[model samples]
Target: MNLQYKTIVVTGGGSGMGRELVIALLKKGAKVAAIDINKDSLEETVRIAGDYGINASTFVLDITDKSAVEETVKEMLVRLKSIDGLINNAGIIQPFAAVNDLDDKTTERVMNVNFWGTYYLTKTILPHLLTRPEAHIVNVSSMGGFIPFPTQTIYGASKAAVKILTEGLYAELKNTAVNVTVVHPGAIMTNITQNSGLGGPKVDNNDKNNMALSPSKAAQIIIRAMEKNKFRATVGKDAWFLDKLYRLAPKFATNFIGKMMKKSLAQH
Candidate 1:
């Protein structure tokens, strides 16, 4: 679907890739409703929008609230006129620890923000999207969703749910005008750990291997994928490489990642 003159709603637009996506969409001449739990961050996003600020609107609300999501969508439709696209970009990572070592509250919080939040927004806005001539839905899953990681089991599980959910939607919407794309982003430069109140080394896009893709780059790829109505999109070199590797050798892929992570953690 053409993004030009269309209206898109982006969750977690306060910062990171979500913020970058909002800006990128504006550049494509699309109106955006930026939703986030942080009012200040949303304000910053709108402020940086510059001349496109007029076309960009911000909503400060917790996506984990089902009632709030429904009401927000209602208000967003009134403000944006229509919802042509929905991007489930807001997510959080669990603390770096084994699953059994993690607390129930932390796990639930991770699941609520990453999985249920996406579900609620999609459920609320999907009916409206189907009513349109053409629409797109983009859900941001993580590499951890496909490959096992030592410390982020809960995070991986939540994202894996998103992956399956997106795929199921794609399968069901095959004959519809609405397109669904699931994105598996490798390590992109974002404050996900900080935002989640967890501590971890963030990926650097400048790495020689180019393992980490910038948020802007990821957003660009996502926009392109949506236009082409692709079923799945992978964002970074690491993501693409690992995805193929996992498909070929799931056991080896998991073990390799585990060893590398162990070494990295030891060094830290």
Candidate 2:
């Protein structure tokens, strides 16, 4: 579907790829309702939009709250007039630890923010999207969602749930006006570690050799996938490569990634 003049609602619009998605949508002449948990970060996103800021609206919302999501969707529709797209981009990672070593609170927080949050927003806004002539829903699932990452087991599970949820939505909405696409992004340069309330990862995220994709580039790939109505899209070369490898040899790919990650962690 053409994004021009369309109204899209993006969660996690406060920063990272979410902010870039909002800006990119504005550049494409689409109106954006940028939702984030942080008011200051949302303001920064609008400020960066500069001239295109006029087409963007910011809503401070914690998507984990079902009631809050319901009310926020109503307000967005009232303000934006109609919703043409929804991007479930907000997500959080779990602390770097094995599932056995992790606490219940941390596990629940990751699940709530990464899975249930997406579910609530999609459930509330899908009805409105179905009413439109053409609509789209894009859910961000990580490469970790498809393959296990040693220390990020629970985080991977949450994203894996998102992957299936998005795919299920795609199957159910095949004949409908709404288009669904699930995204698997590899390592990207973002503040997700800090945002997840962790000091940092054991591996060096700042290293130039990490080959992490920029948020803007990731956003562009996502928008293109939506325009083409793709079923799934991988944001970076790493993600794309792994997707193919995993399909060709699931166990080998999993063991390969597990060993690589373990070595990387050990080095740090």
Candidate 3:
């Protein structure tokens, strides 16, 4: 779908790739409703967006809150006239731990923000998106979506679900003008880890091989993929290589990742 003149909603727009995406969208002459749970960050995003134009709007919302999300959608339609596209980019990463090692609440929180939040926003805006002549839904999964990474079991599971859920949406809407794009981002330096404040030891800071892409680069790649209406995209060499490996050797590939997780856990 052409972004020009369309209204796009980007969750997690306060920072990271989402904020950059809002800037990119504005350059294409699209109206943007940038949402985040962090109101302070939202203000900062909107302030920075001033150079972009008046078309940028901010909505403070917790995507997992059903009533809040529903209400926000209603208000957005009334305010912006229409929601032409949605980028389900709000997500949190669980610290490395075996599923059983993570507390029940911890696992649920990860799933809620990473998977259910995406699902809620998609379901809420779907009706409004369908009303438009052309609509797009960009679901940001992760390399973990395609390949299981140790300790990140919940994070990986949620992304994997998003991968399949987004594909299902794409398949279901194939005949329509609406488009769905799923992204598998390799490790990029961003606050999905820091901001989440999830428990357990963090991933090693020196995993240079995996942390190849920057948020800005990731945002650009995402926009390009959405423009092509690509069904799936893998960002960064780490992510790209992982996707290929996952497809060619699912068992061994995951095993390697599992070992990495174990090492990280042992270090912690």
Candidate 4:
């Protein structure tokens, strides 16, 4: 699962952890096809990837756009000549509003990008990836995926679905050349929360997890997981411990998370 000299396709690679991954992969001499809706951010990613002679390039396409996803990946395969791995990082987090408050557009937008987008790209690339002797699919699920947070129930549900989807892929691909890995990221400093409207009173933020690792650090963890072909990797101590607690007592864990969310949502 070495990333060096391999071709990797990363969704949402224009910013945050996805962008960090593109930088790291390029450093390892991998030819990366970075995808994002923001062409400007994607260009910024390439500028930082100067180590690879700027070999990394961006594809401006919305992951939730099915036709665009298919066409984009096809073009990537044509240009790179191979698909070694895919990191599904493109996602949207709407306002931290209750389900009743959440509008149809927001709900559908989140589901379409976070869940369906992952599915569309995975399905389109699985066959091509399977053709390679050793390929990987890294699905970026979240700590939220493991433990439900108030106002984020639907978002969590979408991520949780991604977790199961990854597991299913692993189950069916057993003994096959391809590897499926699920990543649960801890609280990290990224534009995702702020840009996607996850902050403010809409969602809780009282207990700011400052032990929060940066996207670059998280990217390193993910790269390590790929090196070991880890079936699952939890990004920080917080996310790991919380995941265990979740398995032990989902009922209690749910209540605890609710409190945390409430705290974060404290008067700002």
Candidate 5:
């Protein structure tokens, strides 16, 4: 869990939080294998990690392709020598629309990347992780995973599945050497919408000041969580507040969130 001298695999490491995590892990002296579909962004990540010397490498692969994932992880292990951790940060958002208005293909893609993608990698790497003395697994769920959000229902559902899956893994690994941590991040400034192939809204001028967290900060928090072997961590104020609110008053929390998202929902 110290991360130092350990080897970790991070999905979606081309940019955003995933890239930040690669940088952070390298700083901690961990060997990293950064995976993403974008070779250019992955190259950029490795460039930034140059100061860390040969402790980092990049892999270009689609997580949703189970066969590709299996093959890639096998090759990744050869490059990294050994794997001590797996962070599933690769995911996509659904088009902004209600479930009734959403297309089947989009729905499937969302679930495939967000949920099954995580599953595929986890399944492939778990046995190797078990062989290690200690290892960590970090899964990025979202505030929307536990809190309902208009126009993001399918995206939320996919993340929700991840939330439960991580929790279940934690339970199963209670007495094992591997540790599991689920993360719920809120309003981190990232190009997720653009990467997901959905044009995002122009940033509200107010949003520049009001956003809850940054990818670097989130990466720091996640690394801390891994070091501490925490069961769960919420990355931003909004995520923490919503998590508490939903647990205390699900109906009221849903209504409140719906009200806040009314404008965006209308556009959808």
Candidate 6:
């Protein structure tokens, strides 16, 4: 579907790819309702948008709260007039530890933010989207969703749930006006570590060979996928490569990823 003049709602719009997605959509002649838990960050996003900021609306919302999500969606529709798209991009990672070592609170927080948050927003907004002549829904699922990371097991599970949820939506909405796309992003240069209240990953951001994809680039890829009505898309080389490898040889791919994670953890 064409994004021009469309109104799209993006969660996690305070920063990272979600912020970039908002900016990109505005530049493409679409209106955006940017939602985040941080008012300051949302303001920064609006400020960065400059003149295009007028086409963007900000909502400080905790998507994990079902009631909050319901009210926020209603407000967004009132502000934006109508909703043409929804991007479930908000999520949080668990602390770097095995599932057995992690506390219940941390696990629940990750699941709540990553899975339930997406579910609530989708459930509430889908009815509105169905009423539109044409609409789209994009869910951001991590590459870790499909490939297990030793220290991020719970995080991976939550994202895997998102992956499946989006896929199911796509299948169910096949004959409908709403289009669904699931995105699997590899490592990206974002402040998710700080946002999740954890230290940065051990990887060097300056290393050209290992550098993560820029948020802007990832956003562009996602928008393109939505325009084409793709069932799924990967945002980085690592995600793309592993997705193919895993399909070709699940055991070999899993073992390979396990060894890589083990080595990376050992380095720190």
Poorest stretch of ten by lDDT in candidate 2: 199-208
Tens digits of per-residue lDDT for model 5, 50-71:
7774788889998999999999
Candidates sorted on lDDT, descending: 2, 6, 1, 5, 3, 4
How far residue 176's Cα lies from its native spot in candidate 3, in Å, is 0.6
Clashing residue pairs for model 5 = none
Tens-digit lDDT track of model 1 for 99-150? 9899999999999999999999999999999999999999999999999999
Assess the local accuracy of residue 75 in candidate 2 as a C-alpha lDDT between 0 and 100: 92
* Residue runs of model 3 more than 4 Å from their true location after superposition: 199-210, 264-268
Expressed as tens digits, the lDDT of each residue in 1-268 for candidate 4 is: 8888888889888888899999988887888899988899888888877767367867999888889989998898788788899989877776777999988988988899899999999999999998998999999999988898789888888899999999999999988999999999988767786657556422232346456777889999998898789999999888998999999999999899898889888843
Model 4 Cα displacement at 264 (Å)? 1.2
Quote the lDDT for 22 in model 2: 99
lDDT of 6 by residue, 1-268 (tens): 8999999999999998899999999999999999999999999999999999999999999999999999988888777789999999998888879888999999999999999999999999999999999999999999999988888999999999999999999999999999999999998988898888787754345677867898899999999999999999999999999999999998999999889988988887
Give the candidate number with the greatest lDDT: 2
Assess candidate 1 and give its TM-score to the true structure.
0.96
- Which scores greater on lDDT, model 5 or model 6? 6
Model 1 regions lying over 4 Å from their true place: 199-211
Query: Of models 4 and 6, which has the larger TM-score?
Result: 6
How many pairs of residues collide in model 6? 0
What's model 5's TM-score? 0.95
C-alpha local distance difference test of each model: 0.92, 0.94, 0.88, 0.86, 0.91, 0.93
lDDT of 3: 0.88
RMSD (CA, Å), each prediction = 1.7, 1.8, 2.6, 2.9, 1.9, 1.6
Please state the error at residue 248 of candidate 6 in Å: 1.3
Model 4 collision count: 5
